[model samples]
Target chain A: MSASLKSLPSNPAFTLPQSNDVQGTTSASGPHIPAEFEQTLTLLTSHRSVLGYLLLSRSQPVSIIRHSGVVFEGEQGRKYAHAVGRIVETVQAGLEEVAGESTDTDEIRFMRIRTKRHEIMISPDERFLLAVLHDPTS
Target chain B: MSASLKSLPSNPAFTLPQSNDVQGTTSASGPHIPAEFEQTLTLLTSHRSVLGYLLLSRSQPVSIIRHSGVVFEGEQGRKYAHAVGRIVETVQAGLEEVAGESTDTDEIRFMRIRTKRHEIMISPDERFLLAVLHDPTS
Candidate 1:
């Protein structure tokens, strides 16, 4: 696993030094917010599954701002329970088929499998994940 | 100056495992592009000034991209010029007025100031800044 990992070449890996930091000020009175932030937010917001995964993993409700600039806050986990639950249900069914019983052992195994899938989806965009976690109420 | 820098907290940094090297056999398969590549392109495309700074410091162009989706290609010098230009036009403008010199040297400095500003505003986001020894554009 260690052999497969590639390192990021840049200094200050995730933290971007904005114009304000470079100029040593609270804000740089520029004509516009840098396009990068806008693009990043767009990418993050575009993926609904990522948002759903976040809310589920954090075990917290979240608000998603639509592309039209309207914000919608809700318990995404509860709302998407059917789809996600179906996935969980399917996994449970598979385990029962193999093990011939829905024992305590099967429940634990199913939970681990579900958790692993959720983790795999959420692992890649850690910065966006942090941003969502750190989002101030709005 | 270095003493003013704050140290990061003792939390272990998260590491993402890379499954493949550059141009690896792993094919892209997902609802979205691989997060690693998405981040690299996003960082490169978005933070032109930072890229410029890196390029300037290195004095040579570099190219990077992996099967994971990160792609960057550019010279450091050009990026530096753009960053310097942005700094001059935006942050350094106030400083220039404070200095208040209208000599030929001052005019040359002012022209340099304007050129950097213009380069950042007008250039394509993906285009690399090329450093010219005598001419600002060679």
Candidate 2:
């Protein structure tokens, strides 16, 4: 996998120390994120099934940052952060089956799957991958 | 991280050689899946944004099978099947932060997150977890 496995801080202390404070990095990258990402987040959160979301940039530094729009904390926060990176790698590796000869539409925009106890949602682009975990029953 | 890394068959040939036919094992386990699980799958697929879904059991055998209620196939089929086994393992390892000494309520039932390009929805239960992957853009 090309992704780095750096663990995100349990809190905000893990912010990058470089000239780009977390917010600057986030906004500069924010335009790259689509508008619908949050619209869907609103839909899921309104349903109360959503736990939280993590945004990971594959560009560099391999960041595992939580979505500022929602309150994702504690053990659950860390778990989603970790899952985002792995999911991106897995999808990237697995895409060989679909990419075919068309290089233009090679990126994966979204994916959803379930485990015995929880649901996982993922959206990816050239620069970052976004994942949402939620349950409709809750 | 208690999740077993057992690989789900890349193809149907990997079916458990242990006296279980494909249909037999599914029906034996089918009773555990919630009606709400399918309901959500229907909702997501109905939306043009939905790409596909994979439902996996946390119990042994790490099956990466799709539900009978939903038709998940084509290029995405191969991708999610490949993903199921790895995702279960990832989530299990990631859950350490939240599954504390608290009561039943401490565990998360549902979660949703998104990045700029995609969205992932997850619903988890004691017996299994259901995940739906979709794009609001599509």
Candidate 3:
């Protein structure tokens, strides 16, 4: 919580190599779910007890992994979830261009999205984008 | 709308140098609204015509900017905006630790936060965090 802008900034290119330090976890193929990650998600979900949360990659046609949170009302939450992914992707692409084309400017890292009924939290990586959905009211 | 996990992966390490390319921007103290940044926000606000938006420094106690966008509801909205900044700070801290401690297994990039009546969009940086609020139902 004491981090300053000088301390952390986002890179324009998404090119981090995934670490293979995960152990005792089985993976069928790509992107192993680290024990620490699952633990963090479990802690957050239980402590926050949010409406609904999801873990999706930032690539095109986002792939969602483990997700547990309240379903947005009207099942519209699903659409909103998908829409949010696309929107963030677009924004990232734009920011990348802006960072390189114009000049070293606003190096955007993560984005916080608030709608009428949802609070979408998005965190980025060179490769993946993590989004969490919660109804702040509940 | 077509971002896939394989297509987009997180980059390793949180190491991006901050840019000092801001020009012709005078700082009376408060928040130094860079000319280009201000222009970008203005364009986004004009095109989106979103509810009032704010740019608050991620530092403790929070430093707010004279921002554009649709104004938030009333006094309550103002308080919520402040609260949102703190909440995001906490979340980012937690996420940062997760990224470093857990290994590159899950390199989280961005997060989307949703509440009962409002939607908050957050963009992160080592230096600053950007947050946008809007009514999802509206």
Candidate 4:
């Protein structure tokens, strides 16, 4: 019951793993997922893992879950995921403008397109995507 | 001489040379006297000459100039340059928050910084440093 976990609202759609279960693998009981869906799920799972590492290193109580094809929360507290998502979106849009695209006025500006060399990773719960926006200029 | 030229407003003291004058070499009696100043002046001058070529090809007005011994402007117009400076500052702040040091925010955040390379020949008039802000992401 860390402060961050206490801050997030409980999401019944996804189960909250105990502190020890945070690193457990996903069950292989589900149907064979499409490659695209699997890729997206892997990205989300990776993102959750990274975030989990960050939070755990900070001794924060926040936990992330990727399920139901989307990343969600299991804590019974306040969630700052929306804020983090917005920040990611802002960075993506800035990258697009630098790329000479006119995405300043569009919400799709934040959506990172899949590329051969670069990609976004998701978790098993499908709660988040580890989106890596590369700056081709450098 | 125009009033702006006489007083030389320090904010954007540099000006773009006339199209015809963009090819001439710096005069022996140029205003910058010190060797370091002369070298910088030479660099700035050369930039102007290169910009002329780009302007001709792209049909776009691009210029660069030093201001107050600290600031430098790159291509993309007045508003865009200022916006870039602001974005640089913002990214610098964000990086500091994440990394705890003043890293090269320009390199990490925008593809425009890559265009800052590419040496150019200078013109006589110490007005502008013309270079392309090529979209690196493209």
Number of the top-ranking candidate, with lDDT as the measure: 3
Per-prediction DockQ, in order? 0.01, 0.14, 0.06, 0.04
lDDT of 3 by residue, B1-138 (tens): 123311111211111112255444335665555555665565445533236566656677665654555354444345544554555544444334433444542222344443334444555544455555544455
Per-candidate TM-score against the hidden true structure: 0.18, 0.41, 0.40, 0.27
Task: Return the lDDT, model 1, position B8.
Answer: 8
User: Which portions of model 4 show Cα errors greater than 4 Å?
Assistant: A1-38, A41-130, A133-138, B1-76, B100-138
lDDT of 1 by residue, A44-110 (tens): 4554333323222211232222212111133332333222233333333433343344253232111
Give one digit per residue, the lDDT tens place, for model 2 in A31-132. Answer: 434444445445444434556666666654346644633445654555556556665665555444334465643345445444445555565655565666
Over the stretch B1-138, how does candidate 1's per-residue lDDT look in tens digits?
122111101001111213243232424551222454344434433332322212121112322122111111233333334333343233223223322463322111111111211212111112121121111131
Better of 1 and 2 by lDDT: 2
Name the regions of candidate 1 deviating beyond 4 angstroms. Answer: A1-78, A100-105, A109-138, B1-20, B26-138
The residue-level lDDT of candidate 1 at B72 comes to 17
Instruction: Classify candidate 2 by CAPRI docking class.
Output: incorrect
- Of 2 and 3, the candidate ranking higher by DockQ: 2
lDDT accuracy of residue A75 in candidate 1: 36
Top of the candidates by DockQ: 2
